[model samples]
Target: MLGFFKRDKNKIAKDGEDHTVDSMDLLGEKAETTGKEVKTKLHFPPNVEIGQEERYYYQFLNNELPLLKENQISLSGIEVHSAEDGTVSVKAFLRNSLPKGVRIAEPITLLLLGPDEDVLARQEFNLTGLGELPAESSTPWVYVFNAKNVRVKEIPQTDWKLAFELKKAKGPHTLDLEESWEKSLADTDKEKLEQLVKTIKPPKPGEVNFMGIQSRLDDAGALHVTLLIRNGSEKNVKLEQLPLNVEDASGEVVAKGAFKMEALEIKANTSKPWTFIFPKELVLKEDADLSKWKAYVPQG
Candidate 1:
């Protein structure tokens, strides 16, 4: 037979005030506390056990640190950001009115996944030296850590999963994040867009136009992209320098090739499709199980 474990209420009050009582049980016993308009909170110590999806809360008994009458628990949100240096920044908010005795086992953990949900990176943090917080306020805690061989991790086609744990037994844990990049839209495609614009007919009015493009299906499952370049001008335009570039979804260069049309004579309204065979290595592997490949302007 197991016995009930009861805790005594701790009080925090201004000078002299009327007192009330409330009781709380740890495993399964009823505790009591005495105070007027008492507010309770609970907090987990840094050594408390936490899961991949939970948070810790604090409670008050009468006016003291350890709540003997009630147990209050809640969840907190986690935010993760990826940096250009192949590192990640993690941030979480801690409540001010946390119980002094409550313990936390783990701070945070990150799981990196491949295109098919295959885990490629896993990391952990041992949160340290967290004490009492200010009244009705939250403190933002952050950590910046590097990932090993992040080149493969930066492939952009890969998928990632993140998890967090608040406590091993009691839980209000949550895992969430807002992904952001420091670079701008133009910066994302500056190189490739530059190369692509170079292929355009010198910005001459109606001198050249991007007609259409398609991929040629080869037997070996290789891709051959065909781009149409049209001479819409009345003059015999010399297609000497055909600037072209190709990129994958994550602003990464995948393939690049160019062609030169003979001093072609286009009285008006003429077009040609240049075929480009994508290298197998540059394409996403079958093992990745990606249904479609995204396109970006190829780099020179």
Candidate 2:
């Protein structure tokens, strides 16, 4: 009887060891399968070639040039008169051809460059003091410079060009008005705007959380995006006009637009779904991979 009990106990131990080994094998197989699935689902976007000059030009076009073109604002009658006493008086007329409704919030920067394109002196002229630029009107801006304060061997007597740029003000919740004015934007302007928008990733509001992003090609060969947004705020929030930019894995802007949601309001601590359909023309690259694209929301 003692031998029989001992043999039964040994049999039970063997069975237990076999079961444990089988279970480990099954788990290992599952882990390997899951890894393969994840690898298959991952996608990468194509690489793009962009030079530094092209990048800077794109930024200028998007940030400063848009408003000037849209409002038909021009710098004319520029006169630079210098005296023997090292005093330079620069005068220019800013003409606005478009009707009123736009405000130039920042100062217009004028750079006096030498023949070799080296900046000799710089000046900023504020337009906000004059209030909104009226239609078919002209405003005079005068900048006086003392030669001692200038940073050049000598101011160019001839063959000089006045370079104009807008100085951007930095602060929280600052929105680029030029970007918002897209009614008269050209294709090239739109492209530059898309690129500029990609670089501006404002801090997401504490109450908002982006959950996931998915995309698929529709029947018309257009890409459709499904975004999961969660509102963690105590009060309900609206996402009807949420501006978003879609970027590839390489961090290039692929497409950008405001998202429209059927259910605009999201309850507190709840998630909502938003869909966007992008046409082929909206894509920046001809052979862009939608699988690796992500949507980014710019916060105010």
Among all candidates shown, the one with the greatest TM-score: 2
**For candidate 2, lDDT tens digit of each residue in 25-101?**
21111111111110011011123244465344323322332133222445432345566777665544444444343
Cα displacement (angstroms), candidate 2, residue 280, comes to 2.6
Runs in model 1 lying further than 4 Å from the true structure: 1-204, 216-222, 260-267, 278-300
Model 2 is weakest, by summed lDDT over 10 consecutive residues, at 12-21
lDDT by residue for model 1 over 1-300, one digit each (tens)? Answer: 000111122322211111111112111213332332214433343334543223322222122332222332211223345667677543333333323334334354544444565544456666455553333233334444466623354433213333332223422111111122114325544444444434554324455655334554456655566554555454445556554545434444445545455543333444443455655654443233223333334444
Model 1 weakest 10-residue run by lDDT: 1-10
Model 2 misplaced regions, further than 4 Å: 1-205, 261-263
Please give the CA lDDT of all the candidate structures. 0.38, 0.48
Q: What are the models' TM-scores?
A: 0.24, 0.30
For residue 141, what is the lDDT in candidate 1? 46
Residue 111's lDDT within candidate 1 is 43
Model 1 residue 276 CA deviation (Å) reads 3.0
